[model samples]
Target chain A: MTKLIVEVQDLWKSFYIRHNRNDSLKERFISLFDGRRRERREVFWALKGVNLEVAQGEMVGIIGPNGSGKSTLLRVIAGILRPTKGSVTVRGSVAPLIEIGVGFHPELTGQENIYLNASLYGLTRKEIDRIYDEVVEFSGLEDFIDVPVKNYSTGMYMRLGFAIAIQLDMDILLVDEVLAVGDEAFQRKCLAKMQEFKERGKTILFVSHALELVSELCDRAYLLVNGQVILEGVAREVVACYHRGQIPIRHE
Target chain B: MGSWMRGLTRIIRYRELVRNLVAKDLKVKYRGSVLGLLWSLLNPLAMIVVYSLAFQYILRIPLENYPLFLITGIIPWNFFSGAVIASSEAIIGNANLLKKVKFPLEILPFATILFNFVQLLFALLVFFPAVFWFKTGVTPLILLYLPVLALQFLFTLGVAFFLSSITPRYRDVRHLTEVALMVLFWLTPIIYSISMVPGKLQPLIKANPLTAFITVYQDIIYWGRLPSTEMLISMVLWTGLSLGVGYSLFRRRQRVFVEEL
Candidate 1:
């Protein structure tokens, strides 16, 4: 069997929703004296007991309705969010494209931001130097490499972000709705690059709302609803289940 | 011990990221201005002039070359205060990166401190000529400047770590730090000599962590003498205490930084 490169076991994550945010000292001090003025808070569970496993080289897609904890799952796997319960075991390094242009400083030139963004993934200067030309070529931003990214169009910005993520040498890639930003031609290029990534035996966990694309590109998929996985199987079948709007009764 | 070693290795592995962050700050800060680096000197220069007028001419403090004494103490003090103030924004300012990337969060505050340290080095470079002109020429004791500066950096870094970690939870931390620094400035012997303070208040002033650092700078650069053993011991102890408390607190709170932010 192929090695399980990413394994998430009964993972859970929660956030606090404050009705009255007393993050300042004055409010905290006043609240201490007046019981009625105490801030109200509610626990928000973004992910509930999620279990997932991905083998090396497999491309998996996660689909869910808005606010269904899809992006939260990817963030947790990327180690941006700590699990409230259970644990995640990732055997290989992860390049999270969770949000394109994440670490890009707008005041910095495109070339400078490329170095800064790549370093966020723990790449040394030498490694970035090696991949530098290829990333610029792939993004097709050769003309504006020296211009600050604040001046770049949204499409151009995402193209650079996508180029940097794909060009890096990492074992696992977590993509979260990044394809939605770029133009059609750039999106097509991205799809081709992802296909190439697959051919090169890299693992990918993709989160997207594009049903047809998920069906076509992923080998397997999971459908999540209200922070719980409702269906998991071959990509097409999961997409079919989602299309039918079927909600299976849970014994629990 | 094992976890500590792992943390060390992780920091070493991400040294490139630290370098990139420091570089980014420098570029962003100096990008548009033609006077870029000279601007860092202006604040300290203004302080030196104002204090020289008030204490040297107006109050008659009796210390010769008061501007020289002020330069040594004020420059390093500015570094400490500047770093501490900036640290409050370090983690919160990078909310986007913290939410999306998984690299060490500690680098954010650390890079802020280093950015201020770079400016301090520049200020020193600009003022060392003045020190030579005003004070009695070179002493071998001046060789101790780098080690004293190194200890000050670590102590400030510790304060930074502590402040940056807590600021996300308490948004008021930045204001509190500003107020605290205002109070600390007077308590530290920057404009006046330590000898000016009554002997009873001497111990109280010396108890401040910043006092040892500032006095050591004054001793080495202005007095042209080796620091007393007490000052040396205090310097080491403050660095150790700050780093130990600040880093452990940072480690404990870092896990929840994303959640808090």
Candidate 2:
């Protein structure tokens, strides 16, 4: 049996909505002492009692329609967001490619952002320095490395983000449709890297609407409808099942 | 690990981020501005020029080295206020960073103080050139005030961290701080001489930490004298008390800060 690497149980998250929708000083004052029911915070449940278990070295895909709990579930598993009720425990380092350039500063050069991003992912300065050349070569922006990331194109931004994330040496990779960015050539390169990672027994939990790509990469898949998982099992089977149900993935 | 202790360690581990953030603050603030760092020097100079006109030219206080006195007090006061305003929004301004990333949140406040510290250091460099041009004699006792200035730095940092933590939840703390500082600035002799105030106000003025802190600065830089023993002891006590309280407040709120964001 494969060793268990991730376990999530009864995860539930609810966000309060302000009754006054219009955020203003006068409205704020009126709502201050009013009854909470009268003030109207309609609850938005991002995730509802999600439970799942994944073992080491498994490549899993989460397929969901718009407003499905896929991203929220992944965020909770990555420890970025707290579940309203439930717990998730994971073994080893988790590298999340949620948004590659999430923390990149515009004024700082690419070299500086590499240091910033790698460190944000918990790599020491010495480790980043060691992989510095490899990351640069991967991005294919050697000449423009000195230039600020603000000058980078969408493809260049995606390339650099992918390079840094791929170098994390993490036990588990949480990918969220980041591979959809670059050209067909770069997309193949990313898939090739994933295949290489699979050879090393690294676990991957990916979220993508590309059914063909998901089946090509993930051995198992889960389909989420609204906030609940409606289907699970072989990727091809689940994708077929979800599409037949008329579910649409939210396009970012 | 407890979130507070974890935050402290994370800051030490990510010291470079602190440096980068401070650099970012200084760079962005001065960028696209015609005056550049001239703003730092202009602040104290403008206040000194106005005070000289109001006091010597109009009120005729006949105070010795009055402009010099004003500059010394104004320099530290500016640093104190700069750290205050910078830190009040440190958490709020970086809400995007705080929401998605796991970092030692205290660095946010620490970086705010460090940012102003760099600006204050530039102002200090300007002071030295002016002092030599005016032929002001350098004294060993003046150098002795280095420890006192350190105490002031600690005191300011403590308040900034404490306020940064509190302001995220109770935003009124910002407006409250502005009004409180306005009252506190008057209590400080930034524009006028403490000697001119009535004897009854003397003890109260001395009790005011900023007043005491600035008075010590004015003595060493302007008059080339040592601060009185009472002032040194009181300053030390206040610094320690403020630091302890500030750390406690930051420690309490750090866990909920992620949720708050």
Query: What's the TM for model 2?
Result: 0.86
My TM-score estimates for the predictions, one after another, are: 0.98, 0.86
**Cα deviation of B225 in candidate 1 (Å)?**
2.6
DockQ of 1: 0.85
Q: Which ten residues in a row have the lowest lDDT in candidate 2 chain A?
A: A18-27
Error of 2 at A120 (Å): 2.7
DockQ of each: 0.85, 0.28
> Which numbered prediction scores highest in lDDT against the true structure?
1
Give, for candidate 1 chain A, the lowest lDDT window spanning 10 residues: A243-252
Runs of candidate 2 exceeding 4 Å displacement: A21-42, A246-252, B1-6, B31-39, B129-136, B166-180, B200-207, B228-230, B256-261
| Docking level of model 2 | acceptable
